[model samples]
Target chain A: MLEDIVLGLGMIFTPENLFWAFFGVACGIVVGAIPGLSDTMAIVLFLPFTYYLSPIAGIALLMGLSKGGNFGGSIPAVLFNIPGTPQAMVTTFDGYPLAQKGLAGKALNTALLSSVIADACSDLILIFLAAPVAALALRIGPPEYTAIIFFSVVIIAVMAGNDPCMGILSVGLGLLLSTVGTDPHSGSPRFIFGFYELADGISLMPMVIGLLAFSEALRQAYGWLKRQAEGREEPPVHIPGNQGLRWQEFKQIAPTIARSTGIGACIGIIPGIGTTVGSYLSYLAAKKCSKNPERFGQGALEGIAASEAGNNAVNGPNLIPLVTLGIPGNLAAALVLGAFMMKGLIPGPTFMQNHAQLLYALFTLLFFSNLFTFILGKFLVRYAGTLGSIPETLLISMVFVFCVIGAYAANSSLFDVFLMFAFGLLGLALTALKFNLPTMLVAFFLGALLEGKVRQSLAISNGDFMIFFTRPVALVFISLALAMMVYTFAKGFSRRRHTMSH
Target chain B: MIRGKRLLGLGVLVFCLLLWFLIIPNQTEGKTGAEFPRLIVLFLAIPGAVLLLRSGAATGAAPLKGEELYALRRTALLLALVCVYMLVIPKLGFYTSSILGMAAFLYCLGVRTPLQIILTPLISVGLMYLGLGLGLSFRMPAGLLP
Candidate 1:
C-alpha cells in the first residue's frame, strides 16, 4: 500500500499528467460556463481525445473536467437563470435572483468555494474507501457482481425523477441500443439493423453529444429565432460589484456547505442517482433545515452552497463504483470505463490485484484535480461574468458546430451524425410531449448493466429468479427501490390532491 | 393537458404490449439456459406505463398558453438550425461551415450589422480552429482548401 501511494504520487506529479489535468479543467470550465452544455456532455465530447492519452493522463483529464464543470455550471445558473447542467438547476433557485440583486460576484464566489470544498472532501473519502471496497469486491464472484449491478439499476429507475414509467422506457431503449453491437457472450449480432458500423454498436459519444449537446443547441436556436421574430433584444449583461464572500454570509452558509457536502458524497457513492439528484436533494434538505426556508429562492447563500456542494461532491465517489466494481455510476463514468478498456485496464474486482499502483495513482490524481479546482476556480469565477456577456446567437451556433464535430469525430462516420440528429429529434419530440428525458437517459445508461448482471445472476442460479431475493444485499436494494417508488407516487398524489383543493 | 397525458399513457401501454408480443416472444424461443432477464423489464414497463397513462390523464388538463406555443416554436427553429449545421459541416469544412452557421444564427437572433456579421463569423472560425487544432489536437475538417 505504501509503495502504491508512492507510485500514485509520482504519476500525478509528472509534467505530462499534470498538464493534461490542468488543460481538462480549463476546458471543462469553458464548457460548463456555456448555457446549454453540461459536464457529462463536455466529458463525452472530449472522450475521443483521451483515446490517445495514457490511462493516468486520461483519468486525470476526466477528473479535472468533472471538478471544473461542476463549478462552471453555476456560472450560467447565477448569471442568466439557465442551468448548464441539470445539477445546476438548484443553483438557479437562488443564484439568478442573487445576480439580479447585483450580488453575482458573491454568488459565484460562494458556489465556487463550496464546490471546491465539497469536491475535496469527497476525494478524501474516495482515497480512503476505494481500496477497501475493491478488496472486499475481489472476494465476490460473477453472481454477486451481477446482483450489485441489478440493484444499482433498480435504484436508478426508481430515483430518476418525476416519471418512473418514462425511466423504464428509457432503460428499455438503452438496453436495446446496448444490444446493437456484437454480443459479448455469444458473439451473435442481435440488432445491427443491417448497418456495418453498428456491428460494433452505436457509440455512446455520438448519442450523448446529439441528445444533450446538439438538442440543447437546437433549443437555444429556437429561442434566438423567436426573440428575433418578437423583436426582443438580448438583456444587457450586468456586471456586479466586488461584494465577495462576507464573514456574516460565510458564517450562515458554512454549516450548510459542510452538511450538504456530506450528504452529496454519500449520495454520489451510490450508483445511478448522479449529481443532479444529489444537488436537488441537498438543496431540499438545506431549505428544510434552514432558519429561513422562505429565503431559499430569494437569494440565500446557503441555497447556492448546498446545491453547488451537493453536485460537486459527486465528482469523487461517482468513480467509486466504477473503479471498485467496473460498474459505471453514470454515463460519464461509463465513458471512463470505455477509456479504461481502451487502455487495456480491466476495471473490476481484479483491478486492484492487477493494477494497484495505477489505481492508487488514479486516487492521487483525483485528489490533486480537486486541489487544482480549488485554486483555479477562484480566478475563473472572477472572469465568469464574461460568460454571460457572450452573444447568445454566436454561442448557440458554435455549440451546434461542436456537437456535430464531436459526433462525427466519435467514429469518423456520417451515419453517426445522422443518428445523432435522429436522436435530437426524438429528444425534442419527447420534451414537447412532456416525457422526462433525464429518466430516459438514466434508464438507458443503466439498461445494459442491468441486462448483463441479471443474465449473469440467472446463469449462476441455474435460471432461478429467487436468487435476487435470497441475497441480503440484493434484497435490501430491491426493497429500497420499491419503497422509493411507492413513496414517490404517494407524494405526487398528495401534492396533486392539495393543489386541487387549493 | 389531461388529454395529452392520456394519449401518451395509451401510447406507452400499446408500445409495451407490442414489445411483449412481437419482440419478447420471438427472442425467447429456442434460447436455452439463462436468457437475458426480460421479466424485470416487463414487470416495470407494463404497469409503469399504465400508471403513467392514468396519472397523465388525471393531471394534464391545463390548456396551452400563447407563451407555451411561442416557446415551442422557438425550440423548433433551434432544432432546424442544428440540422443545417450537421448537414453542412462535412461538405463546407469546419471554418466555412461554422462561420456560415454563426452568421445565420446571428441573423436569426436579429444581428443586422454587416461588420458584426463579418467580424463574428471570422473571429468564431479562427478561434475555433486555433482551439481545436492547436490546443485540443482535434483535426477539424479542412474541407476544400488544401
Candidate 2:
C-alpha cells in the first residue's frame, strides 16, 4: 500500500495530469454555471477528449469536472435562485434570500468554503472507507432504496415547503407527470397520448430548467412588470454584501458544515440516492438542528453551508461504490464508469488489488483539484454579484435563450423546449397555488426510481408487502419515513392550533 | 380565497385521478405498469382531499391586486414568446429566432438603448451557438442556417 501510494503520488503530480485536471475544472465550472447544463453532460461531452491522454490525466479530468461542477452549481442558485443543477436546488432556499439581502458574496463564500471543506473530508473518507462502504452499499437492494426514497421525500416535503399538504400535493403532481414516460417495469409507455417525444418519459434538463430557472425568469418578469405598473420604473441595484466572509462567519457555520459533510459523505457512499437527496436531507437536518429554524429559509448562512457542503461532499464518496464495487453511484459516476471501461480498466473487487497505484494517483489529483477549485471559486465569487445585477430585461431574455438551447440540446427535440415552456407555466401555477417548486423537482427526479424500486421489491417478494418489514435496513428507513410523516403532521397541527388560539 | 383555490385544486385532483386510474391504465399492459402510478395517484388524492376539506377552515393570504394581474399578463406574454421561439427555431434557426426574440423582449420591456438591445442578443446567441454547437457538438434543430 505504501509503495502504491508513492507510485500513485508520482504519476498524479506530473505536469500533464495537473494541466488537464485544471482544464477540466475550468470547463466544469462554466458548464455547471449554465442553467440547463449538468455535470453528467459535461463529463460525457469531454469523455472523448480524454481518449488520447494518459490514464491518470484522463481520470483526473473527469474527477475535476465532477468536483468543479458540484461547486459551480451553487453559484446561480445563490445569486439568482436558479440552481444550475438539481442538487443545487437546496442552495436556493437560503441563497436567493441572502442575495436579496445583498449578501451574495457572503453566501457564495460560505458555499465555497463549505464545499471545499466537506469535499476534502469526504475524499479522506473515500480513501479510508471505500472498500467497507462499497461492501455495505452492495447489500442495499430495491426495498432499501425505495424506503430511502420514501424517507427522503417525506422529510423534504414535511420540512421544506410552506404547507405540508401543498408539498405532498406538489410531490404527487411530480409523480403524476413522471408517469408520462415509458413504464419502468413493463417498458410500455403510460401517458404519452401518442406523442413520440414522451416515449422516453420527461427529459430532465427541460423539466429542471423549466421548473427552476425558466419559471424563475417568468416570476421575475411578472414581479418586474408588476412593480413597473406600481410606478417603480427600475429594479433595485443588487449591491453585494460588504461583509466579506469573516472568520467569525466561517466559525459560526463550522459545526453545521462538519455535520452536513458526514451526512453527505454517507449518502454518497449509498448507491442511487445521489447528490440532490444528500443536499436536501442535509439542509433539512441543519434546519432541524438550528436554534433559529424559522430563520433557515430567510438567508441563514448555515443553510448555504449545509447545502453546498452536502452536495459537494457527494463528489468524493460517489466514486467509492464505482471504484470498489463497479456500481456507479449516480449518472455522472456512470459516465466515469464508462471511461473506466474505455481505458481497459474494470473497476470491481479485484480493481483495488490490481490497480492500487492508479487509485492512489487519482486520489492525489483529487486533492489538487480541490485546491484549484478553492482558488478559482474565490475569483468566481467576486464576480458572481454582477450576474444578479444585470438589467432585468436583458437578464430574463438571456436566461430564456439559454433555456431554449438547453432544452433543445438535451435531445435535439423541439418538443423538449415545448415541454420546458409548459412546465414553466405549471411552475407558475404551482407558485400561485402556494406549492413549492423544490418538492416537485426533487420528487420528479426520484419518482421513477422510487416506483421502479418499489415494483422490483414487490416482484422480488412475489407481491408480498411484508418484505419491507422483514429486512433490517429496509425496515429502518420505512419506520423513519412513517415516524417523520406522523411527526410532521403533528407539528403542523399544533402550530395551527397555537395560531388559532392567538 | 383559500376555499376557492381549494376547488381549483380539487378539480385538478379529480382530473388527475381520471387520467391516472382510467386513461393511463388503458394505455398500459399489465398490473406492473399501472400499479406505481395508481399508488402515487392514490397518495396524491388523500392529501388533496384533505387540503380541500380544510380549505374552508383556513384563511390564507390576501388576494392578488390589479397590478399583479397585469404582471401575470406581461409574464404570459414573455412565456408566449418562448412558445413562439420554440416553433420558430425549427424554421428560422436558433440564432435568428433567438436574436429576434431577445430583441422583441428588450423593446417590450422598454429598453431603448440600441447597444444594450443589440449587444445582449449578439452576446447571448453567440455564446450559446459557440458553446452548445461547437463545444458540446449538440446538433441544433434544422433551420435556414444549419
Worst 10 residues of 2 chain A by lDDT: A233-242
List candidate 2 stretches off by more than 4 Å: A1-115, A126-130, A228-369, A380-388, B19-21, B55-63
**Residue pairs with backbone overlap in model 1:** A171-A443, A218-B78, A222-B74, A222-B78, B1-B60, B2-B60, B2-B61
* Model 1 lDDT tens row, A1-502: 7888897677677898988888788878877887766777778677767776888998789878877887888888888788877789999999989999988889988998898888888888887888899889988755566667656766666566566655555555565556556655666555554677777767766777777667766776666665556667655444655667878888889898898888888988998888888898889999999988999899999999999999888868888888888777776777777677657786877788788888888887776777777677777777776766667777776777666777776566778888888877777777776555554554455555566767777778887978878887777766776676567667766766676677
Each candidate's fnat, in order?
0.38, 0.86
Identify the candidate with maximal TM-score. 1
Candidate 2 lDDT over residue span B55-142, tens digit each? 2354676787998888777777777777778788889987888898998888766678999888888888888778656865666665
In angstroms and one decimal each, the interface RMSD of every candidate reads 3.8, 2.7
Best candidate (score: DockQ) = 2
**lDDT of candidate 2 over A465-486, digit per residue (tens):** 7989999998998898788767
Model 1 bad stretches (over 4 Å): A80-84, A92-103, A231-238, A243-253, A280-300, A341-346, A486-502, B24-29, B32-34, B40-44, B47-49, B52-95, B134-143
